[model samples]
Structure formats: structure tokens, C-alpha cells
Target chain A: MSVVRITTLSKSISNLFKSLVSPLALNSFFVLLITLNISAQDVDIAKGKSLYNANCASCHKLNKKLIGPALKGVSAKYDKEWLYAWIKNSAAMIKAGDEQAIAIYEEYNKVAMNAFPQLSNEDIDNILAYTDYVPEPVATSTTVSGAQSSTGEPSLANDIILGLLIVVLLVLVTMLYLVTKTLTSIAEKNGIKIDQPKSEPFSIWKAFIKNQFLIFSSVVLLLLSSAYFAYGYMMQIGVDQGYMPVQPIHYSHKIHSGANQIECQYCHSSARVSKHSGIPSLNVCMNCHENIAEYNGEEDLEKGYTKEFYTNEIKKLYKAVGWNEETQSYTGDTEPVKWVRIHNLPDFVYFNHAQHVSVAGVDCNKCHGPVEEMEILYQYSSLTMGWCIDCHRDSNVKVKDNEYYTKIHEELSKKYGVEELTIAQMGGLECGKCHY
Target chain B: MKKITFFSVMILMSFLTLSCFDQSKPNYQFFPNMYESVGYSTYQESDAFANGIEAQLPVDGTISRGWVPYDYPDTNEGYELAKKELLSPLEVNDENLSKGKELYNIYCAVCHGSKGDGQGILMKREKFLGIPSYADRDITEGSTYHVLMYGRNLMGSHASQVNAEERWQISQYVISLREKLIK
Candidate 1:
């Protein structure tokens, strides 16, 4: 009992000490204590941090309210024995009509906390210690600056070299001009007449105009080139191949698909079964975004995609979904996000995402380009008849594991006298296949 | 002077034509009637709806085709009851397990970890914290389905993305992962 009292007293003193010292000083003090290998409490704190992250972090945050209340300095609010009982089985305490437990349960909309019967009293103490632990401010700015400088060096040197080359070229040109000017002046002074061939070249345009054959041929050439250009321009009409539109919300495919490695079909799930790939509803965004309210990943500062910018975009999502971050509830007022469509096929064309994505096992990247790498999505394919026909002519129909194609694949391969049958041979290039 | 004027005019015309190409806007179609659908397309904007959007929520109490109604309430008591009583309707087989694995990898594996070890890429990157491992949790097939139907805590309901059969398949896969973890 005396030992317990003494440890409690020590804990109070440490808590007071923690409040008094600045982060830098406290960190230094901790380093000194750790090096001395005398502070067992510090070790407990470390263990507590890991334990807290493993068990408590999902619902409880130290400085902010998540599913539960902010748990910072929780030890100060309740008795140690009571906390132990509560952590072990809060539902039991609530049912038993414990005032504190019931109050908490009611306060958080009767959302009962998950009981950690697996965690012992010692582990709870460690977790509590972790909750009270104040992390030292890391020297991340210095490291970031160092990285920026290192990466900036090559580009900076290249710019300097480029500027030097330009300056040299300018100097050479000026020197040539100066030399020619001085020589001309000297020649004039020395009475050496420098004949200027100016009028003859100026009349060359007139001479060309006078030649009817040359004029006619040139006019024909101009007309043919203009016709060719007009045809090229006409062909490109309504073919939105690189048509990138800014979305209502800035959704970075690079971060989600590339950095996070989330599969394309995870959000565009209808691609497996439906005609359209389907623009994911706002609820899909909430699947991951509900927990991840802030941006902690990489940033492109030059493009103004900062942590705050990304976080604000998330706030826009919350607004559209009508999610109140503080209370963690929907306000029942929703503004549907009007996402601009990037890829569109004309009404005349019949295209099924499921046919390509699931049946054929065609990769999304084959048409969508490297969507994982794109920060902004754009139409990668021209979606023209020629483009479709080209792919159908070259690409083989995926026959493996498809029972429906078993007999047809064999017959077609035999008829074509080829080892494999292209999609065109499989009637993919038929006019009726795409046009209805 | 006339030639210079003509050349300047040509340059100006070229610049005017080239500058008209705006990437943000769609290009001019040969025939708007043919290019655009006369019938309402997916996500088309029309004055027919009150919300000024094409997609409308289903009428109250109207069930969609193939959508099985989930009777379990979204409450702590419901969670406990579901955990205790809910059973998988689908039979355990290689086909279901394989399909479950594929779906799980696409959706659950992002944060839940592929091995159900609570050490997914998101966890490692510190995006999500305190994701309990399947072995650590007191879970059953029922609880897993319940959680998937009406998402518990931070997770949102994936019912929209996956159907009932897919959910059961995923639940079976999760149980299998838990079994593997126990060993």
C-alpha cells in the first residue's frame, strides 16, 4: 500500500514536471535520463504509446474527440481503480449504473466503448501514460530544407549553365555586329565603296508574283496543304482524347491510386458488372475519408497542393456529404457533387465497361493510360472507329478460363489457321457490335 | 506594304484559330443531335427533377431489385445481438473464398491489412491508427456482416459497393484470415 502511494506521488510529480518543461528541454532531459539508464518510467511510457496506438487509437484521440472523448489527462478525472474496471468492461459499469460510465455513455450517444478484457491493469497504466505523453517537436523543417536544397542543386546548376550559354551567344552576336560596324565605318573612311545588294532581293517578291506558273503551283500547294489541315482538324472534332476538365473537388489519382496503391475497381466497382464504370457516389469517399480528415501525405507545393489545400478539399467533401466533423454526424443537408465527366462516347456508339473490364480481362490502363500516375484525369483514348478497329485487329481475345469461348476459340483458331484469334476475328469489329 | 498587311492578317487569323482551342471545354461536334442523347443519360442535368440532378433517391420503403433488406438496427445492442446470432447464408467453398479474397484485396485490404494483422499500408503510413487485428477481436461471421452492413465507428457501410453474397463471401474470407492468424 505504501509502495502504491509512493508511485502515485511520483507519477503526480512527473505529470507536474511534464507540464512545466518545454518540448525541447523535456526531450533533452529525456535523452539524458535514457542515456543514464535509470528511468524505468520512460520505458513504461514508450510501451504505453505502442499499446495506446494498437488498442485505444481507433476510437480515442489524446487532444481531440473521436468516437469517444479526448482522453488527455484522464487519470486526473477518475480514480485509478475505477478506470481499470471501466477499461476492462465499460458496458458492465454502465449497466451497473455507475454514474461516470452512464454519463459518458449518454454523452457519446450511447455508443458503448469496446471492452479490452485482454489488456491487464499494467497495460492500461502504460496506455494512460501514453495518452499523457507529450511528443517532442521533431526537427522536420531542417530535414525538409536539406532535401529541397539537394534536389534543387542539379536544376539550379543547369539553369546557371543555360544562362551562361545564352550570355556567351549574345556576346558573340554583339562582337560580330561591332566588328562589322567598325569595318563598314573603316571602309567608308578609306574610300572603299561597299556595294549593298538590297533592291535586288526586295524585288524577288515581285518577280515571283510575275511568274504565273510559279504562282499557280504555289497556290495549288497552299490549297492542298490547307485542305489536308482542314481534314485533320475535322477528324479531331468531337474526339476528346486529352480532354482534361477540372473537377468540382480536386481528387488526386496519384495520391489515392499511385501512392496508396488503392485498386481502380475499388471505387469504380460497377465496372465489373455495369455498362458505365460509374462515378463513385459521395458515400464511397466517406469510406476512407471519415477517419482520414486531414492530409498527411506528400505535397506538391509548387502546384499549390499543400497539406492545408488537400485538407480543405476534404472539408469540401464533408460539406457535400453534410458530415459534421466535430460531432461526427450527418446534418441531413447534402449538396451533391457535380463532377464533370472526362470520358464520353457519342450516343451512336455502344460500349460496355463490363465487357472489356471483366469478360475480356482488359486492363483499365490499356485505354485509360497510366491512371494511377495521373494527378488530373483525362481521356486517354480517341474513342474513334479506326482506333477501336486498330485495337480489335491487333489484340487477341482472352480465351483462358472463359468457358463460353471454349468451342468458338478452337473453331476460329482452326479456320484462321493461327495459334490465337484476334478480337476482330471473334466478331468484335462487326458494325453491329458497336453500332445499334 | 500590302504583302506585309496580308502576312500580318494571316498570322492574326492563325493565332485566333489556335487560341480558340480550350482544353476545359468539349470540342465542337459535327451534329449535336447525334452526339448528345435525346433520352436522359446517366448523370444528365434536366429540369425534370427537383434537386436539378439526374440521379434520384429511391422512393421511401421501396426496395431495389435483388437488394435483401437488413433487419438489424444500427445500435450497440444490435451489434451485440448480431454478433451472437447472425449466421452466413452462403456455403463455404473454394469459389466463394477466391472471390472473397479478390474483393477483400480491393476494398478491405487497404486499411484492414491483407493478412488481417492491422499492419496495412495505411496503418504503416500512419493514416489510420489502432486497427485491431482479426485474431485480437472477438468477432464471428455475423458480427463481420453486421459491421459491413452498417459500418461500425470510422468505417463506412460498403453495402453500396458489394452485394449481400459478396459481403458473405468477404465475411467467410475474414474468418479464414482470422483462423490463419490464430495459427
Candidate 2:
């Protein structure tokens, strides 16, 4: 009974010291919580977890190295008193030439850590405990998901394809057998028996062996079919319609475009007027990303990308843009993020994004495919000459209310006697329209 | 002979299967010269170019063909002066308003919000604060253009992103949004 009271007394003192800023809430809640936690009074791991998440989560992760180092077993690395002082004011210690403090400051590229003067020793301890806390592993969930989902393939599609192939093979075999049987029956009915001659050589092509004309024609047919297939394979050599490259950061257009409904022109603003749909510079990223430093999607891992994966990617952006989220100021340590360009038109093709987008009013999705739903962007269109010519031939010119085309439209309509004039009709098919 | 034929058929089948899988690879171009031209990249530095820079800047005090130079300087005085004087060159119509709305949603709404109440995604998430409501301010099309031309406070200049025509269109859209917010 005495031991129990002493432990409870100690817990209240620790919690009181931890929550000094919010004393009234702590005192009132501690009384209620004491009854529930009367027996095992130790480091409140849950309280620590919430506190760590609220304050330190933006720059720190428990197991992974984030903007700051991982906090897992961080309590073991330094003395309790030192940690308390450092956490409360790291810059002061670093300025004062404290060896350990200066080392950490330098280790993280001289980017100063934010001071948490309000967090008490006990509160810091609670955070440390939460970092050390590990839950039991669940292997079943990962295995179950892995078995169901495979990249570039859905199980249903695979089954359907296999079923179709089997059906095709069965039909071909049945036809061949039927044809052979019918021919043999016809020959037997007419008493034209195909007998083995004593003088004839034993050849594999017995039927065509004696007939030079039949052999020559069959060989010619085989050669023509092989050439057809070979020509088809050669034609598709450089047409990378579905080329998906891994970028420096895993930016999901699906979440930004589809889920958030950010307009395509918002980031790629130059697409409206420029020849190229420009890759958004880092400054464009910082416009929203300065505030949106963390990712907290209310769902399971998407396409095997865990919560940690996306959160870290955002951190990489911060590092690249030299943003210090703590003071919300740039740290002046900027580096250019090398992004791999996906859509590349050949030198011969003079494609103007503005001509198609601003002038013609083509949707970005018409050429880029359904980018809104893409987890990773890829070249959506074949972008062949035939593809461009086809679009120009069929697509109607938007000349109704658009001022840019109205004058040209009136003259063309009178000349051609057609109200709906395609882009092809408006000199879109001219060699000089795209080339030179 | 039969075994050799079977092996050859198996080899052909494997080649067919492999071809089906390489979907990400592009088709071959007949002429390499057409595909890859001998030209300098836009941003790449060249030894022969001045300052090793490829893109050249226009002479000072000169504007491009379509773009007119903004007269007012970037200052508080400029903002105040433009507010009283500046009026949109373009008239208020469905054409301008829709384009204005579309442009607003692109550049401004990410911070200022679609409704212009300053409760954009950045505000709702508490990433940034203190963005004033359009209705709260006494603004004119000129002030809006001045702000876009040379940014105020936390917002940076958007002159590079928008043209003079687009700037006018956006000012029209913002004025309409302000009227809606006033109600």
C-alpha cells in the first residue's frame, strides 16, 4: 500500500513538472488518470508520442534520419541534463562553444535547431520513451497486400489474357486437324492413296517434296509473313509512349492534381504561353510547400509508398529549397534539384505548347494522358507525326467566341462554305506549320 | 533435325515474349539526324557565349514587342498611388471574368483562396497567416496590378508569370470576388 502511494506520488510530480505550462489541465487530468494507472506508473509513452508528434515531428522521425537525426535510442546517446539544456536552447550552447552541441550543429550542415524552452525534462523524457517504444510486427498484412497487387498488371487482366490464348490455340488446332482429316477422306474416296514408294527418298516434307511449284509457293508465303512481323517490330523502335523514369523525388500527380484538384497550369504556368510545358522551378514548389511541409493523408499506404516515404520526400524539397521550417526562413543553403525530363519531342518536331493550349484550347490531358490519376508520370502519347496529323485533321477549330481566331474564321468559312473548319483546313497541315 | 526445329521454335517464342514486355522503350527513329539535332540546350553554359550563359537578356529600359513597361516603382507609395489611379484597360465581360477566374485559381487561390477570403489551403492548414481579405481592403484595379507587378509583403512579384493582359483579367476577377465577399 505504501509502495503504491509513493509511485503515484512520484508520477504526479513528474507529470506536473512535464506539463508546467498547462498546470490546471494536468492537475485535473492527473487525478482522473491516477485511478486508471494506479498500478504500473511509469513513463507515459502515449503522452510522449503525442507531444513528440505535435512539436518535433516535422524535422524528426523515430527510426529514419530526417531533416534532423532519428530519435530512436537518442536518450542513450547523451546525458539527461545535457539533453534537457540542449533541447531547451541548442543555439546558446553552440554559441558558447560546447563541443557536443557544436558537433550536432555542424553535422546537420550548420542549420540551427529550433529551441523548445517550454518542454520540461519529463516531457522530453516521455518523447524519448515514445521513440524507443516498438510494437509487435504484423507480417500477415504486408504479405496479403503484396499477393493481391502487382505492378503493370492486374490479376484479372492476366487471367483473361491467358483464357483468350488457350481458346485461340484450341480453335487453331481443331481447324488444322479437321482440314487434314477432310483431305485424307477425300483422297481415300477417290482411291488416290498416298503410298510410300520404294524408290522415293524419305523426306520430312513428303507432300511438297515431289512438287517444286507447291514447295516454292509455301516458302514464299512463309518469307512474306516473317518479313511482315519484322517490319512491325522495327517500326516501334523509338516510340516510348509509356516511358516512366524514376525522379529524384516521388511526387504523385494523382494526389496533387486528382485529389487536391490543383489546376495543371498552376505549377506549369509557362505551358499557357511557352513553347515547352516548363518544369516548375523550386520557387514554384516553395509557394505552397513552405507551409505544407508534412504529409498526413488519412489512409493506408498507396502503391507501396508508406507515410514515411512521402513525408521524407517533402523534407528533400525543403532541403533543396533551403527552407528552415523552424523559423520559416530560408537558410541560404540552396541546391538545384535535378529532375529527369519525361516528355521529349524529337528535334524535327517543332511542337509549340502555347499554340496547342492557349490558341487551340486543348486540354493538357489530351497529350499528357490522364495525369491526374498518375502516381508516377510517364509519356502518355506516342507523339508520332501521324498522331499530330490525325489530331489536326479531325479536331475542329475553336473560332466561335475566341477573338484570336474570329477574323480568320470568317474569311475561311466564306471561302470553304463550311461552318466547322478543322485545324487541317486552316493550314495546320502545311509543312511549314510545325517544321521550319 | 526435329530437336533442332523445336529449339528454334522455342527461341522464337522467347523473343516474342521479351518484345511484349519492353513496353517502356521508345520506337526506333529511321533518321538519327532528325531525332537529335546539333544545337545548344537552353540553359547549358557554352564557352563561346558571354559569361558562359546561353540565354541573353534584353537591354535595360527596353520592353519586349507586346509587353509595355510598368511605370510605378515597387513601394508602399506606388501601391497607394496606383490604387486611386489605375483602371483596367479591358472592359468587364464574361470573357474577361472567366479568364480572370481561371488565372486567379492558378496563381493567387493557392494562397489567397478561391473565394478571396484568405482561407486558402495554406491558411486552413495554418502554414501561413495574416493574409488580408479583399473585401477588408480599399483596393482598385490599379493597386491589384501594382501588387502583381511588384509584390507586397510575403507575396513575391508575379510580373514574370503574368502578362499585362492577364494582369488586367485577374484584377477584374479579384474585384468581382471582392464584391461577392462584401455581401
Candidate 3:
């Protein structure tokens, strides 16, 4: 139902062959190109795009200034002959001391542009024409820019449900009171003895208190409740398994790792070779945040976040990084984002990230839990010594061609007469292994 | 009046209990000594030094052990010189090249495309522009190492992120990528 433009086709066609290896394929591709090139009128934008992607896209874009100035409306800036000569060989023109060529080289801090010597004059013209060609803007996705999903306002639904329940309860109470009043009135009319309802409550309370069975049951109830609360309170101490603190930046691991599928090591890169799983520095955040300055997707307010909330959170990153969107440059007015640490272990215990991640080959989720699904990161594991001992007792060392584990693995396997050795056998459970 | 007072007190009691239930706050610690420790926490400042400097960096000009010195200075002349002279110490083996490719994908491929064609996701999405293809230019291992050591133009130095050997590995990978682009 959508239009498939030649530009998209050209992009795909070029992508089909990653790098031109076969001479036959190249010749046939060129022949196909020449046949497709026979469109006499429409300015050859598709061919130009193909040529541009092959020759120039790696370095230049239509609107943005990357390693060089933007190429949009570039044809208007230079005449045909000058453009052809420049495109054919800029180095020669620069050496010849051509003013324009030298100025362009000087403008971008002397970063040289590659020459397209093989491109014909017409080919260059087509490329210049494509530079002027504009693609139609696509409609914004329903997910990002549309009527928000129902979950966007969860509190309203909860409030309505609560209000309805309260109304129903009030109505039920009123009906019961009316029925009882009517029954009393009928009894009085019939000349029957209608005893006062007030005295009944006190008599019932007194009789219940006098019963030994009731007293024993009350004591049992009190004991059970005390034991329950006491056990719950005692168990909560020093075990912050679900401790999820509010961070300075609202960085959702779910959106990043779950939705985006970014590998954990991409951010926490030092996990593979360091003692500490180092928190990602601001530069790493800048890698993606520099571009993704706003959230466009529909955010669920049910999660206590609005669409604007996420966009504003991204603005917080910009403020910390000191990046100005207009100029697209850092202002050098930087501040460190103080992230709240969640998983804290006792000082006496020793743990090395590189040992587990690099050597043992333990998945990050084995300890960190399903971090990708965590919107707000929590201390998923107990991080207790018992938790550590249990894992070491059960898990085996990843000893496949691992030079670090070769000698130890050989000795342990041979001695134990087992193909695989659990970490405990490799002295993992030793008190000195952790406490020291 | 007594029933009204009792209901008000119950409501007040519930409100008080609700205030104590903060899910974001960590549970009460058992032993302060066992949890808190006698030592200062990471990144915490202490007033031991006269200037209140917490960083215990060695007195100026003393390099830590195992830190090899790079001869090139952070200048354009140094870049040009390194480009002309710098050679990778590591042999061009599959393992080194593979590692180099992996590192390149992590660091460089964000701005420099995976194929070293400069159309990385950032470039395609129009975040950063004008990244040159590896095939387009004449680059050597020295230049790559020097660039990694001291970033040129918009790119920043990656010396802190990657070590000397890793830089060489990345350089080797880039050279191979350049070869592919040239074809």
C-alpha cells in the first residue's frame, strides 16, 4: 500500500553487494545501471543516489555537516565545470592553488576530500542533481505521535474503580439500615416485644470476653501475628534484594537493553577485564545521547512516567554533558551525574568482575537478574555470602581453551576424575578466596 | 461522638503507617559496622589533605608502573608524523584482527560505519556528518594509533578507554577494512 521509490531500491541494490568482488557481477550491475539510466527527463535522482552512496555517502550527508559541510543545494553554490573538475581531482586543484578548493580544505581544518576520478561528467552532474533532490517526508509512527494508549493514564482508572466501589458500599449500607428499620416498625405495630438493638452489641461483647475458648483463640491470634511480624522484620535486615533507588537520570534499562537490544558490555565495557564493573562514564552516554535528545515514543504514565517526563529526562543528560543542540558542540560546562549504587556488598567480601565475566563465563543476568526488563534497576540478587557460596558450589568453570584455567582445570579434573569441575573444587568456596 | 473519634483515629493511624512505607528506601541495616565499614566509600571526599583533595595521585610527574610512554605530542604535526611513521607491533593474525573488529564495532562503528565507510548509524541518522570512507584516503597504522592517542577535530582521544595493544589491534582491523573498501 506504500510507494517503493527508486531511492530505496537503489540503497538496497547497493547493499546487496557489500564490496564488489566478482568482475562479472560488476559488469552486469553496470549494464543494469545504464539500462535503468535511460530515463530522459526526471533528473536521474535515483542513479545519482546510487552513485552518491557508492562514492560519497560514507563521508557527506545532504543536510548535516559531518567531516565536511552539508551537500544540500551544493549544485547552486558551484557551476558545472568547476564542480566536475573539483570532483574529479580536488588534490590537484588544491596543489594548483585554486582559491575555492583551498578554501573548502581550509574550512574543515585541512581534512582532505577523496577524488572521484572514475566518475564521468554526466555522472557528476547526476550526483549534483541528486543533491538537490528531496525525499518526501514520511508520516510519524502511531507509536510515537498519535492518540496515546489507554495505559498512559492509569491513575484515573484506579480512582474511578475505587470511587465506584465506595458508592456501591454506601448504597448497600443504606438499604440494610432501611430494611432493619422497617422490620422493627412492623414488629412494634403487631404489639410484639422489639428489644433495643443497642443493648445486644454490649451483651455479645461481654459474653464473648467471658468465654475461655474465645480468650484462648485471641491469645493464639496475638501470638501468630507477633511471630509473623517479628519474622518479617528480622528477615528484611541486611537483605536489600529489591532495593531500587531513584537515580539522578531516569535511565531505563528496559528501554535501552530490552527495547533497543544494546549489549550490557557495550556500556559497562570494563566488566570483562576489571575488578569492579565500572559504571559507564558520561562519554559513553554521549555516544547515543548526543543524537537521541528526545523521546518520541508513547510512554506509559502507568509506570509513573509521561511522554514529556522522558523528553525532559533526556534534557537533563544534555545539561550534564553541556551539549548545545543548535551548535552541536560541548560547552565544556560539565557536571558528573551521581548515580545511586544499588548492589552493595559487605567490605570484607572480595569479588572480581573479570574473574566471573571473563573467566567463569557467567551471564550478567545470572547475578544481576533480568536487567533488560528492569525499568528501574534493582539489586536483583541478595549479594550475600550465602548466595555467593551457593553459586560457587553449583556452577562449573568455563575451561574450554581458556589459558588462565588450563593448569588448574587439568589438575582438578584429573584428581577428581570428572570431565567438568565445579567452582568449589577450584578453591572458590575458600574463606580466604573472598575474605582476604 | 465516640464512634466518630474512633474512625478518625483509625484513619490517622493508617495515614501514619502509610508514611513509613517508602518502597524506594532500603530496609533497615542490621549492623552499622558490618555494612558501613571503617573505610571511606568510593568517590567520597575526606579532609585528610590540606587542600581537601581526595585523589591520592602520585606527586606530579611520576608515572605508574607498566605505563609505557608515547612519544607523540597532541598536535597536528605529531598526527602527521605518526601517520607517516607509526607501525603496529602486533602481527596481523585472525585473533588480533577479530578482537580489533570487535573493539572497532563497540567504539568507532558508532560514528565510523562498521565497514569503515563512515555511514555509521549516527551518520545515517544525521547526528554526525562527513565521516570519510577508509578506501578514499591513504592511511597507515601509525596515523591510526596517533589518532586514537590524540583525537583529531571532532573525535576525542580514546586513550583512556582502550590500551596500547588494543589500539594496535583496532588499527590492524581498520587496515583490513580499508583493504576491503579499496576493492
Interface Cα RMSD per model, in Å?
A: 1.1, 7.1, 4.2
lDDT per residue for candidate 3 within A65-132, as digits (tens), equals 65577899998998779989998998899999999999998987777666778889888878887999
Q: What would you estimate as the lDDT of candidate 2?
A: 0.79
Q: What is the TM-score of chain B in candidate 1?
A: 0.92
Misplaced by over 4 Å in model 3 are A1-42, A46-67, A78-95, A101-107, A113-229, A288-311, A403-417, B1-21, B45-62, B73-80, B94-139, B151-156, B176-183
Model 2 chain B weakest lDDT span, ten residues long: B20-29
TM-score of the first chain alone, every candidate: 0.79, 0.55, 0.72
Docking class of 2: acceptable
Q: Write the residue-wise lDDT of candidate 2 on A299-397 in tens digits.
A: 344356766778899999999889886656689897666667677788877888998888888999999999998988998898778999999999999
Top model by DockQ, which number?
1
Q: DockQ scores for all the models shown?
A: 0.73, 0.24, 0.29
Q: Which stretches of candidate 2 lie over 4 Å from their true place?
A: A1-204, A211-214, A298-303, A403-411, B4-17, B20-27, B44-98, B110-113, B118-133, B136-143, B146-157
What's the C-alpha lDDT at position A194 in model 3? 62
TM-score of chain B of 3: 0.85
State the weakest 10-residue window (summed lDDT) of model 2 chain A.
A296-305
Q: Tens-digit lDDT track for model 2 on B59-146?
A: 7977688988777777556777899887788999999999999899988996678999876775555454446678866788899999
At residue B74, candidate 2 shows an lDDT of 72
**Tens digits of per-residue lDDT for model 1, B27-60:** 8899899988689987788799998878787889
